[model samples]
Each structure stands twice: as structure tokens, then as C-alpha cells.
Target chain A: MPEELPPLGDKVYLDSAAAVADIPDGAVILLGGFGGVGVPENLLAAMADHPARELTIVTNHAGFGERGLAVLFRQGKVRKLICTYAFHKSAFVFREIYMAGKIELEQIPQGTMAERIRAAGAGIPAFYTPTGVGTQAAEGKESRGFGGREALLEHALPGDIAIIKAHKADRLGNLVYRGTAANFNPVMAAAAPLTIAEVEAVVEPGEIAPEAVHTPSIYVNRVVLGENLELRSEA
Target chain B: MNSDPKLEAAALTPGDIARRIAREIPPGAAVNLGIGVPTRVANHVEPGRGVMFMAENGILGAGPRPAPGEEDWDLINASREPVTAVPGASLFGHADSFAMIRGGHVDIAVLGALQVSARGDLANWTVPGAGKGGIGGAMDLATGARQVFATMTHLMKDGGLKLLEECSYPLTASGVVGKLFTDIAFIEFTEEGPLLREVAAGLTAEDIQRVSEPRLLVAGTIGTLTREPEAAEPGA
Candidate 1:
């Protein structure tokens, strides 16, 4: 009898480093996270050791404290940051480099940033939004009137690679997230040409219900196991 | 009004401003509370009001900070503080979450401000000399919400007036603020400009105007602002 094949062609990778080994220098990386949650810490650690340089990171905020993206920022690997929030009390690493004029910062309204990324994934070239009309954020952008209100044109924000974290994933790379950790992962999963997911667990192909999948298998290219660093409050 | 101890003591506390804003939120409104003082407004909304709290980080029907053992780091608000989800909460990704905000689905946005002009212009996210501070969601919230309510102290830390004829700081949005709740008064921005609606219990209309750079139009019946007793602590 012929050998039976694994269902759905397993996309799971046992090593995080190997999953992200081919990311080129100067790549535009879509990192998924909002604050400390939903960050691919293991993948970031791997990238920190990888020989990539001058990467352009796009995310919600600069990394909080000394973990995740901070590791990349500390190593002087990033060339520019495209984000909504760049400086926070704990984002010392980003603040230092940003203050020293060593890295470039392109700030946009949070909603605009999210929509631009979504547009990239959905194959929309650009869209108009009323979120920054008449403000400095609208400066230098194309403007048109819509429904009697002014709107500003924002372009799509695409990425060469995406590194996201999820609570669980099937061997086929379908993912599900826990609570708000779902923030940018799903959108980014579709926005990048090469997508890598760091998940808490990788189950068999049929383990995760089809309806429960937050990110479909088609958008993900690789999956690797990562530690759950969720902080526990003192009871 | 140069930092008079007596006036400072009489000014409403941040808690008072939050409660005042909470009372004005219509029942069943989908409200987005900005970080800091605006976040406290959620704690003061009366139960059964059916107000849905939306956090920009991707949760609707956001609830209070989770009880000690129940906290989930994955469940956090815009401030990145661990939070809980109300029973009927819905979670989404960043794109969809922001769509609701910029699409005018959010009824109200309660935000903090650095300065507010009489014409309802808001200056919040950054100071003039301060190096590029984070923009976050302020511009989106200021421009997209059906109504924008700002909460801030009446005076700057150095005794400069925050209720100005025109904001000197860079604006978050032009003519976006619908109402203002400060430490000393409640004011509304109308077609006729700023209308002083209420004054703190210990203050008079003149006291408010003395510090306001804009000429406030006094309401026909200016109500006295009062602070109700604090509610029981959450998760106590």
C-alpha cells in the first residue's frame, strides 16, 4: 500500500529561528502587538540574533520596556519606525534612539495606521478617511469632500514580512487568539508576503474548529511554538 | 488666579470631573474613553445604563480592571492596563476596531486636553516644545466621534489658562470638542461659542471667567456643580 500523507500539508516549524531565517536586511516588518500583549517574543529574540539590519518596523507602539521589539531597537537593527504611538513611559529604548535622531519616525493617527495596513492586505491602493481632517495629520495628504465632510487620503502600508503571536494554531496554520491579544495579528497576517506565527500551541489539523479560526491558513506561511508570557495579577 | 490655596482646594478633583462627564453620557451610547482621566469616566457610569465601552486595542463592551486573580494580560485597554470584558463583549482585530471608531459608530469620545479654544478647537497630544509626543488615537477620536467631550484641569500646572480664546499648542483637531468638563466648571461649545453651563459648588461665574482667556457666555440658569459620594470600589 502507498504511504498515507499528512492532512493539509503541515506548516508548523519546530524552531522559531529557522522559520524567520530568510528575512532580508532592510525588510519592512509588520510586527503584531498592542503594548505588551500579542507580541511574538520568541520570534523577536530570534531576529535579535539574526543578521538582519536597517529593518523598518511598523506597529501600534514602540516596544514596552526591554523585551520584544526593544531587543531589536537596542541592537540598532531598525532604520525607521512607522507607528501611531512611539513614546511611552516604558519605551526607553525607542525614545533614546528617536531623541538621538538615529532612527526615523513617521507618526499617524492610530485608526489611519490600522486602516492603511488593512488596505494593504485587502489590495486597496488607498482610501479617504475623516479621522485627521483639518489637523496636522492631514497636512500634505490629498483631501476631498465626502458627504459634506472633508477627508484625507491615506495610502496602503504593506510589509515584506510579518511576525505575529497567537494563542493557538492548527498544523495547517489556522490561528485563534485570546481576548484583546488579537489586535493586529489577523490584519498583518494578510498584509505581508511572508508571514510567521509564534503560537502557544500547535494542534492537529482538525483540532481547531473552522468557525473558531481568527486567521485562516491561507494567510499564514509558518507556525512555531512560543512561550506564553501573560502576566498574572496578585490575587 | 495665581495658585491660591483656597481656590485650589475648592476646585473639583479629577474624580469629580469624571462623574460629571459620566452623568451626561446618554444610556445605550457606545463610548470610547481616552487614556488617563477619561478612563475614569467608565467607573462612574450608572449601572443599567447600557453604555458600551470601546477600547482602541480591540474590544467592545470593555469592563473594569479585572479582579486580582482574574486579570488577563491579553485583555488590556488603550492604556495597556489589564481589563475585563462585559458579558456581551465582542473582540476584533485592529483594522475592524478602528473602522468602528473612524466610521462614526462611537457615540462619544471622552478625552484629556492640554488646551481648548472657545471655538471647540482641541490641543492635546503634544506640547509646543516637547519633542514629538505620541499621537495615539487622539486625532481619530477627536474627529470621528459624534460628540467629543474633553476633561482637563482649568489651569495649566504653571497657572496658565487652559480655557483659551485660541489654543497656542498644536491642535489635535479643529473645532471638534462639543463639551468641556474641567476642575471648576462644565462648559459647552455652541454655535455662539463657549457657554458656561455650570460652576463648582464653591465658585461663581466671575471666578471661572477670571481664569478663562475666552469670554464665557453665562447660561441663563447656571447650575452648581456637585460631587456625589464615591461608589463602592470595584472588585472589592
Candidate 2:
């Protein structure tokens, strides 16, 4: 912690290394991304070199190729993965590790995964949803019939911290996302005890319109620039 | 998309099965298409129709794939394939999108199948004990949609019937499939049991029966299935 803060409503700007320094080993991390979009790239790069080990990562998909969470998996940082899709065409690393019994996996239906995270943010302990009633996803869980159909009991999925990406941020840490990059970032920010956001640019408060902010400043603890934002491909 | 080009020449292709299912999509209905054979339904939806395409990955009003070299990584589908969105498109998070589905906002969901039981129980996400078995979103879509339509080949590659008396594989959902469109026939799951609605051209009702383990009920108005849009009567 620093001795003196910059000013009221000014989020502490940290370099990638300092931003990730507090995340301890075996932390339950909520990662914001869908496919390759909206991934906290620089933070993940920092994590590649960081000493945090045996992490439990919760995200939408098992990342493909050699980037994002796949890199974390490759570095042997992930102990367990809780996600929606464990198998996809781009899954090179997870397939090898998971099949070899080197890692643990808990596959939740996509909607159920999102709702569980959102439920944590909303301070709800549990809710009944019709997502995985009769499937393997509902195994060993309590279920009841509602309106002549089964609804599975799902609990909240709170996390120690959320590392997310956004397009822009204000000094107050209000965020704005570009395109479909908005998928999990907003919800994950609210679901965690601490939230670190990676942004393309951080401007003064008045620069971003009030209503345009996708994630309010209160949910964010720190902000880091992704560095060389222009080179980041939107395609 | 056909993953196997060698099987493309095989009759009752995935595309052909998709076309048959596309005709059942009522105009102005909000529809969700699962990955695999059902994903091709977006290509067959008639333009300017009021149909709203929903993807569980948080997109509504999703359109067909963009022309070559015009891909937008930010605008991809649930399958992670680059796609375009129709006018009035809406982007949301996974929770909201599935809320639309489970809350009964979506009118129809078309899915691929490994096995559809006589009672409409569906198993598509896995081959029993396969290392790659993962359910994804099929369980949600199966239980959520107002109406569910399954599209796939009638038989497995080894000449085994996919329409069965009971699902031997793990089920994605139970008693939810309303209809099934296959390469060889169109079948409906009713309170009574599996009803054979229509058979493909040059194929007899007995041909489908020979492969089916469940007793199939032939529809009173059963006819040969056709691809020409005009061949289907308006709202037939």
C-alpha cells in the first residue's frame, strides 16, 4: 500500500507486475473473456512470469492456441479449471493436460456459469435455474420441480479477484468495452473481492460519458494500460 | 459445416438435414441453433424474415458468416466462428442471453443429436466415456426453449440408428425434443411416442422402420420430404 493516494476518485494505476503481485497461490480467479476477445493480455503476460501457482481459474471457455489462459495452463499455473466448454476445436493445451489426468476440470453449462458468477456479485447465496436439471452438470446437486419442470439449485461463485480487459477507463476507473469484448468483464468485476482492469487508454473522468460506462468505478480496484493499444487487432 | 468432406457426398447430408429443419421455423420466431449440424440453419433462414437468431455465447439477432476476408473477431458466434449480425442486433452477457432462453424468451432451439429416445430424451454432448466428452450449452438449450428441434443424420457412421427406444449414452436433457429432422426422415415426438412425419424421396417407411428400434407411428399426412421452398405449402 502507498503512503498517500493521488486524489479522490482516482484509481491507482499500477504496472502489470505490481498489479499482479498481490494475487496469492491457489487463489480462485475469475477471468473475463469469451474466445480471445476481452482477455487481460498484459496481466496474463505478467502472470506468465509471476510466481502465483496452483490457481483455480474460472472463465467461459478453455482458451485455445498459445495465448491467454492457455499460456497459464502451459506454464503449469492452473491447478483446476471451472468453465463452460472444456472441449473446443482450438483446445490444444487443455486436451493434452486434462486427458493425461494432470489437471482437474468442472464443466458448467455456459449460462449456469455466468449466472453463478453474477449471483455472487448480487450477494445472492443460491438460485434455482432450469439450465442443467437432468444432465451431468446437475449431478449430486439438489433439484426440485418448478411449474411442472425441474430447476437445479446453483450456488454463487465468488472469487478472490477478477482480472479483466476493457477498451477505455476514466480516472475514476469507470470502464467502457468495445464490441463483444463486453461479455464477461462487467459481471466478473462485480463478482470478485478485488478487480484489476487492463485498458487500452485511461483518460480523465469527463472524457467518457457517464451513461456510456459499462462497469462502474466502484467495482474496480486498479487499472493498467495494455501498452501499444493501437497494435491490438480488433479483427 | 461439414467436418468430413468425404461424407459430403453421402445422402441426407447435414446441409440437407438443415434445410428440412429450416422450413419448420415459423416466421418471426426467435431461434437458437446449437453447434454442428444445427449451426447451418442460419444459412438457410430466409432473408427479411422476422426470425431472431440467438447464440448462447451472448448474441441475439446473429446473422450468417461474412464474406471471405471480411471476418470480425469481435463479432463471432458461439462456435467461435466469425459472423455478421442482422439489423437490430443485440449483444449481451452469457447470463442475460441464457435468461432469455430459460425465461422462455426464445421460441425455438435447433440442436444436433447423438441419440433421441422414444420419449424425446436427447444425448448429444458425448460418446459414453470419451475423453473429449463435455456438455457445453446443450443442456441449457434443451431444457429452456419453448420448442426444440433436433437435426442430424438418421444413423451413425457404422449403420446404427440414432433414433432409439432408450438413450444408451449420457443425456443432455430429458423429454424436451418436440421434433427431429434427419437425412432420411422427419420425426415428431408426441405424448404417445415417436411419430414418423415424413420420409425422404426414394425411401420407404419400412426402410426407416428397419433401422429404428422404437415403434414409429406414421403420420396420417406423411409425404416425401422436398427442398424446394415452394414445395412446402404456406405455413404447412
Candidate 3:
């Protein structure tokens, strides 16, 4: 919303993300996905062309071998990662983060993480829950009595641009998400500095229903056609 | 109403039941101890049994307490308390860790409970407006572990029962728990029903019968709750 970068016609909007080749290294990025599903492979591949090193990432899954947002980690672009489950990529992500002491990683309890993100999106500011009151996750965190047990105040996540993939989007930017891909994209779109979505198809504004829209156009800034439906369905 | 036999003991303290459940575990078993009373079992396994403790956040073979000057800053269990790993223990992530539990690789799972219903319905997981459900892995373990046991105080306040003909608490697993080890008695669950093994010392069967919420099926014979070993006195 800056005067120089009014939401529309902003120079930052490279006709397609390819217009600018140099993104500042070590930038914080939030990706949406679980495993390989909903991954923005084209945008990720585009980002990979440049050596974006030491980047901090927020995501749900580490992806499977070069498929999930983890391709950035494999490319050695991520310096830190915040996630719930990394079982699929633990051999590299866990060992390197916890064992080898290479990158800093924070693993959130799954259900708690889901609620925390939802809380942030809902503008609750701060709230307490008794989920991780006594476990290791409780270390270095303040806990207060709630009801009869204890709850901890886990801070809401603040991100740089949040990048997501959705099934389709209208020119106005209202989006539709399909299948397993809905994991973290919807919540994260509103929680970041900027949300860029890559869609399988783009149609006119009225094509999508007002209620069927998972993310309204206000939350989405830019949309790029990444792949055709016929080609995407094959995968 | 039915000729119940579990009310076989005299009187039992909370700590007595905790210690009894602790002793029941054999050494070298892969164990997942649930929160609350069962967590205390970490202190009671037999010596030199090579017990491997597992925490859901991906630690295996965790030892009770870390040795002096041996604390590694990075090494900790799900509780985040300083801990030592048993010999040959290694690290794994959530998927592998859960696969270990659900894959029937774990030998025993000890859980805390509000109630073990007559039909063996476990109601532990609590929902916000619904009640309590830490659910963690309790649901998976109930049906997965080779042995499942419950450790808790027998009766709730207000003269109510934690063991009922049917559970009032939300059930995580149905008919999967093997034993109910409580402050007052020992019960081995079966298709025939909960057959009582031992009762608290000093309390008569009549006293227990009056307190039991459901009609507990009686065992053919009764045994006395075992006393702590002689060496246990000095430590106390």
C-alpha cells in the first residue's frame, strides 16, 4: 500500500515472477504444503535458479526429496525451518538441524500448531492453552493456570511473503483450493507480509462463487499460471 | 450387585499403587509411559534390564536421570527435562517414532485413566466443551502395544467410581486395555471380564464391594497384593 508501490502496477510485480532475477538472500519465506502436494514447483524452480542462501522458511511439511518446499533446503537456501511434522525429511532436516548443528529448527506439536495459526489469523492477539504445559516444548516459555490445568502462550507467526499454490483463481484473485493441497495455504495467505499464489488455471472474476472462495482477493496480491490442468492432473 | 471379588484388599495409598505398577514392568521392554501416574514408572524398572524409554518427540532409550557432568545440552526427552540415553539408544523423527509404536514394535504402554468401563471402553481424550483428551498416542497404543495397563487412584471424589459398567468418559480405544492397576486392586481384563488378582491390605472385600460402581466379575481365587522388596525400605 506504499505510495511508490500502490497495490496494483507495483514494479515488484514482474509480469510473471521471472522479471526480477535477484531476490535478497536469507529472506524469510513461508511455503504452503504437506509433503509434495500443493507445492509451487514452478515458482520454487524459478527461485532455485538464483542462489538464495541461508533463507528461513515456515511450512507444514519438509516435502519429499526436491518436491516439497524442502527443495530450498536441499538447494541449501534455508537457514532455519519452523514446522509441525518433518518425518519425511527428518534424515536431512532433523540430523542437520538437531544433530549436526547446522540449521536452527523448531518443531511445533501438530494440533497446537494448527490452533496457533488459526488464532493468529483470527486476530486473537494472544491466548493460552494447556497443551504443552509440562513437556520439553514448555522449556523457556511462560505458563499460566487455565481452568484447572496449565496453558502456554505460543506466539503467532509473522512472515515475510507467504507463497502458496491453489487449484484455481479468478482475475480478481479469489481462490479455490483442491484436495490435500489445502493444508497450510489458506491460513498462511493472510498471515504473511505478502501472499503470492500460483494457480493451475486463471479465469474471469465472476467464475468463482463468493462463498466457495477459500481466500478472498484482498489476501491475494498476485497470481501466475504455473501449469495447465491436463499436464498437472497427470502428476 | 453381582458377587464381586476385586474388593479384596485392606487399604491402599496412592503411592502404593504407583510403586506396584512400576514393579510390574520387566526390564528391556520398549515402553511408552503416558502422562500422570505412569510417568513415575521411569524410576521403578528392575536394574540391569536394558530398558529403552521412548518419547513421542523422537527420543529412544532415554535414561531416568542424567549423570553428573554428563548432561549434553541438546539431549532431552519429550518432557524436556535433562536425561540420559540408555545404551545403544538413537534418535528418530515423528514418522519413524510413531511407526515404532503403531507397528507393534513397542512391548508395553502404561497410561493414566479416569475410568476403565465394565465393557473396557477407555475415555481419556478430553475435548474443549466435551471433556479431557490428551489423546497423544493413547488411542494408538491401546490397540497397538503388546501389553496395555492403566494406573490411577480407584475412586473419584464424591463417592463415585472411575471403573464403571460403561464409561462416561470419552473412549480412545475399545476393549484393548489389559490390566487396571489402581490404588485399591489389580484387574486383568479378558473376554470373560475383569478378573480380580489382588486387593489392598487391611481392607475387606465387603468394603470394596460397597465402593465399586459396577459389578466387577470375581476371580476363582484371590491373592494378596505383594509387599515391596526388603531393599525398598532403606531407599524410603
Clashes of 1: 0
lDDT of 1 at A180: 91
DockQ of each model vs. true complex: 0.63, 0.57, 0.03
Q: Per-residue lDDT tens digits of candidate 1, residues B109-194?
A: 99999999989999998877645578998888888889999999998777889999889988899899999999889999999989
- Docking class for candidate 1: medium
* lDDT score of residue A167 within candidate 3: 80
lDDT score at residue B183, model 2, on the 0-100 scale:
79
TM-score of each: 0.95, 0.91, 0.49
Evaluated on chain A only, model 1 obtains a TM-score of: 0.94
**Ranking of predictions according to lDDT:** 1, 2, 3
What does candidate 2's lDDT look like per residue over A1-235, in tens digits? 2478666867756688888888999999999887777788888888898999999999887877777678889888999999887887677788888888878999888778888999999999999988777778788999999888778899999999999988899878899987677778888999998999999888888899998888899999999888643212322
lDDT of 3 by residue, B1-236 (tens): 33224443343554566677767778778888876667667766665877777765456787665566765433455433456666687754334455566557888888887788776666655423411123444555665667888876677655467788877665656676788887778888878877777777755455555666666666667666655543553222
Worst 10 residues of 2 chain A by lDDT: A226-235
Ten residues in sequence with the least summed lDDT for candidate 1 chain B: B227-236
Q: What is the lDDT of residue B146 in candidate 2?
A: 95
iRMSD in angstroms, per model: 2.5, 2.6, 15.1
- Cα misplacement distance, residue B1 of candidate 3 (Å): 18
